[model samples]
Target: MKDAKLSNVFAYQNITHKDVFLSQKKYLSLFLNTIMNLESLKQLFLYHGCDKIYVKILSANDNSKNQVYLSGSYDVLNIFPISEIVADSSGDWKKERFKASVKFSWITDEGKITDAPNSQFILYPKYPEVRFSGFLQKSHNAPSELMSKRLPGRLLFMSVSNSGKILGYVSSPESEVTQSFNSLKHLEVAGVFKVLELELKINYRELLLKELFRIHSLGWITSKRLHKSGNILPCVSSNCGGYTLEAELGISANGYSEPDYLGYEIKQFKANSFDRIANEVITLMTPEPTGGIYVDKGVGNFIKSYGYEDKSGKEDRLNIGGIHKSGVRQPLTGLTLQLIGFDTETFKIRNASGSISLIDGNGNEASSWSFTSLIKHWNKKHNQACYVPSKSVKVPLQKYLYGNKVLLGNGTDFQLFLKQMLLGNIYYDPGIKMEFVSSSKPVIKRRSQFRIKSGNLTNLYKQSEIVDLLKI
Candidate 1:
């Protein structure tokens, strides 16, 4: 029974009037025989509980010879407990009994079940083959440009290997589709895969510029109207602008998991707004400090040791806000955030200054980071950033002003950024603060920051483009 092919076990028949007899005894016998056959079929297939089923995915181009085994479960009848099938007690067997349907479930390494697998499998009993198909069509609701141009093909199977490599098989002759699957499988596993280049439908830069110009053409849009109408507006707060731009662009505003504003970070600021004066320093990231005197201390303790008084001069308040110039001592901490081991001119990190060292509380220098290491971390988040400038109008009722004239910062120049930092034009200012309410070690709000003057932005970025809001 275990070795029996599905074709040999399941039978299909077409009954005609001649096959039936009106005699009550004969009719009863026929009914009993039909039930017995169904029972036998069920027993043969579910003899081992039917909880575990293995799928063999073969390459159609290779004549179904090369294959990979993927563990899965069939959800037909009462075979799998993931869904239940109930029988009716009304004695009308044909209408009351649960209909048998084909369903398949595959468990991912992350313990997630792929969606709607039952509909994705196209079984060919005559060919004695079950092919998983229609994934590209069924899984994505993307623009046609982003969709595969080739004919929809059968999905072979995909599985994660023991070595953490993703293995996939597709029964398709289209090399492009198969190659795309191969290249994107790793991103798929991480759950952050997105084909933005295709999904965008148009040149991304052109689209963004067009949108920006449309906004600029409006002259001025009231913040009250934007907030009430749920429309896109240039927000005063950088944080608020980040969220508003996402909503305007039809992107989800909730998590860091997905790319922001279609694979680019949208940063809005008033014209001539700098990182320190505006308190809007570009935060590369918020990774925990790796080492130094700060390593042993908790965030609260570290703030207590290094924090200074704000304008109010409150006791035990830590204000990690001050100018950090290369070679020159920092204004607040008296320590320099120098480019020690890197060639300042070439923007390269050298082996001698392999690590950025800082003097600790005990007067011993501790290695903080090497230029090579920092650049790697920075590159991950700074891939593409859009800096926008806005014109602000004071709102008498609100704490912040309304930003109207939103201008685009075409692109960032990493090399210019390094050069600026070396020349004291750009600086690192950690805007961390500790609020001591009842003296239970205080609550800390840490904002790791890197700042540059608003006027010096041209040196760190490419030429600006003005977006006309009215046209969009």
Candidate 2:
């Protein structure tokens, strides 16, 4: 299988101290081969109660010691959780990261499942990369033949389920599965791995579009919310517009970034008019802070330290409301948003211990959201989203009518979110409030919202489009 011309063309430095060279066409061909239909391949994962699937073709250097390289960006961190970054003494290699915790298993062609408890994903933020290892270490019934050595061209299909387990399947060398996947899969990416946005029965995007089209045919729906327990409740408030859309779609409220319907977040925005899908402030995410005074102290203490008194002539009330952008101080809160460990100019994480922090006047950390914490939420909810502009009615028994024209965004990385933050297209607007401030235990409601205008939304995704359900 060695042609000196091809071998010399793609030979890369093999880290295993071996004379092995993989072809440029191996990666190049896989990128362009999009005709392989993988419906059968998808059904296997679906049968295992998995919802999202990602693929990574092994390289000659992708071994246990070297680890499987994930990505240079924070996107893969969104899919697979990483352990806290352990900074070393020297800055030569930058940062070394490990998997937080994961349960990995191998599913055979016969549907047999075996656990690979040692399986872990490591991150090298120096290169700002992630790698895979431990799967073939002391594991039985695992793909030792494919993963144990410096093997190239073996396909790895890893899926994430609602239960948080990462299940995987490796194609046998020269198996028909690899051939079909190479020929028929969509050229989509998920972090370091290629995203398998399959045409399956569940995770397929077109199926969701068709369902939305069905709801579009319904004209309008009564304002109501579907409970996660499958109960229907009257949604008579401003949020009823979003609630009604979820109800019509038969989806239950799954908190932040958890897939709402068909592995996509269902977002309903109150549009002034649907003719152009008017610019509206969309709540991107509401992840709580994972560090600084927010975690060291309490939310009450943090709020008292940084928040301002309510300006609406309301007694015994405090509020923190307004826009907070990177490197800029907000007058009301008296805290500036700062991005640490990241080089916004290069769009890279120069340090793994980086964070989005709110620093107080005296240079104290009021609250900080670590890269590990934010990336988990950023793309999980935003990776794929369907933004539906809606108009609500309260006079006629409360109802919501969605526009036939919908905006569908796919393939986003947390890096895009950060990139937008750098440009001031996205800002942190908190609606935190404390009532009965003088009481023994004052009630506090915290809402940390990162919002963006609908017009600027396209900058966050790799592919975005206005879909007319009627046309479909």
Candidate 3:
């Protein structure tokens, strides 16, 4: 039974009758499929027009269970460059920012052309659970229905030089499909889309290269696609479909100042067609410990993984914040507040909300009140002048004033919270240093942080008063 199971893993279905003296072997096929260097990429680039091209293979994975699987994606992204690449935005001196809508084209080995779309790109670390089958067992074989319906996709990246003279390409597994019911489920789901398939019906490589050529002709520097990597072998056992070859590659960014540049790593595999009665596509995957090759279903338990949740089309809550005067009924200015986690406990706010309200002890009902209303209420009740104290005063009012005069998003969130005052838009007309103070003060006398010829508030005297009042 064990030998029979082992035979299934390495089974090779015959395409045509041929007599061979040697017995079936799996390792022989795998050894022939693997490509360990970057020479191929360099060759592809030179073939197009590049004077010189650098190529490096980082890592790779391969698996076989009656079919082959390979996948790949590109490394181009609109990101903040390592050395700030700046451009004059119609007299606006904006810092380095990402530009959208860069397009590219690709050409295939057989002269086919294809279009490459543009969008955001991100590189993530690979997990360790990818597995592969060493040998197969009939009892362990995937169900016939599931095996018949599988369709796996391969991935690759092909690039051309900036001069439009050279082309480069790398291919690996993007992902795969497995199980008849599950595969059907994917097709049945409405509003769902499946990419163009490259398999039995089509000469996968020829189609892939043709698309690459299409992208190249369209002026795209490169094209990326998925493909299975392995050669077919003769069938050795009964009830065999054909030889299935699998290959996986691990690509990692080179440790350059630019974190975006990555090098490719490739692995190749070859196994008999009849090793197992599995389908063309292997959907569910299990990681093998040896390297990157992953095993499809017909194994054991599956685990859930966590990642970004889909919150598309969800409404966002309306929240606002700003600086408020001590006694003013109306807010001087207001801006929307962006929320972020501070510590595990409470939220640390860098700016005060423009509006204030008194809430019940239970934190339910809120009675709206403004700074001017509060001051009027206080003055009416006390019949004495109510002042929002400066830092010079040793009282709760002074603490409140200190906390209110804050400059946020100036280097760091915590720094703004600790330092109450902020100098706004230094590039524009140097304005007054906004500070927390009591009401009834003339706006013209507001102290200016940047020196300018103007009103008292903008004058040196008011500026001195502001510095003295804030104790800064």
Q: Which model scores highest in lDDT? A: 2
What does candidate 3's lDDT look like per residue over 42-130, in tens digits?
A: 33333333333222221223222332121121112111011111111232212211222223334333222333332111111011011
lDDT of 1 by residue, 265-302 (tens): 56655444422223334434444454554565555656
Tell me how candidate 2 scores on lDDT: 0.72
Give the TM-score comparing model 3 with the true structure, all chains together: 0.18
lDDT of each: 0.40, 0.72, 0.21
**Candidate 2 deviant stretches above 4 angstroms:** 1-57, 70-93, 96-100, 107-111, 153-164, 169-203
Best by TM-score: 2
Estimated TM-score per prediction?
0.47, 0.79, 0.18
Where does candidate 3 stray beyond 4 Å?
1-107, 110-160, 163-168, 171-332, 336-472
RMSD of every prediction: 21.1, 11.9, 32.4
Tell me model 3's lDDT, rounded to 2 decimals: 0.21
Arrange candidates by lDDT, highest first: which order?
Answer: 2, 1, 3
